[model samples]
Target: MTDQWVSFSKVGDAELVSLTGEIDLANSGEIGKAIVGRIKESGKVLIDLTTVSFLDSAGVRLLDALVGDLLGHGARTRLVVGERGAARMTLTLCAFREDVLTTDLERAAADLK
Candidate 1:
């Protein structure tokens, strides 16, 4: 499935998936599945949430599951959640690991090294 909010690229050895716009109940499932289907989990990955403007409960759950699935499959995953960005508070409230979140895209990529 093609999602307008999702785009894929590569940064060094990591696969970069940048998400834009809002991610809510209506689209989070499809988005999560699309990502899981497209990414090979044996390497490094960076999920850039910096451009996301909204992250609802379903979106948080999608990210939590996606990150867990990737790590379980031996992939190192990092999330680019800017400190003052829209997704940050929701992630913080959901108690996502601080180590997995970063405010910079470059930092997210570097962490994969």
Candidate 2:
């Protein structure tokens, strides 16, 4: 994908940061920064990893760190994971707690609303 291709998008009241291509060590910090910046702008953030083709340990760590930072900033965060191979693997490996990261965006938004 081109560098100009944004892996993120702000949709409605939620900032949807999509992870496309490979999320390895090189782009993990960038992804974290993008998410953090969006969180700073809006209290609500949703990470959509539906298009993510691959994720390494570095990517997972970055996501975990981002979640912690968002929590520290008192921002609400949710993760919308696609029901596929890499995306499913990432979610399962993360083992994210429901109180921290939610799987459904609509339910999360309703709760937040």
Query: Highest TM-score among the candidates is held by which one?
Result: 1
Q: Which sections of candidate 2 miss by over 4 Å?
A: 1-6, 98-108
Reference-based TM-score, model 2: 0.77
TM-score of 1: 0.94
Q: List clash counts for every candidate, in order.
A: 0, 0
Q: List the residue pairs that clash in candidate 1.
A: none
lDDT tens readout by residue for model 1, 38-81: 79654898999989999999999999998888888899999999
On lDDT, the leading prediction is 1
For candidate 1, the lDDT comes to 0.88
The total of clashing pairs for model 2 equals: 0
On a 0 to 100 scale, what is the lDDT of residue 94 in model 2? 72
Backbone clash total for model 1 is 0
| Cα lDDT of model 2 by residue, 39-85, tens digit | 67667777776667888888788878887877678777776665555
TM-score against truth, every candidate: 0.94, 0.77
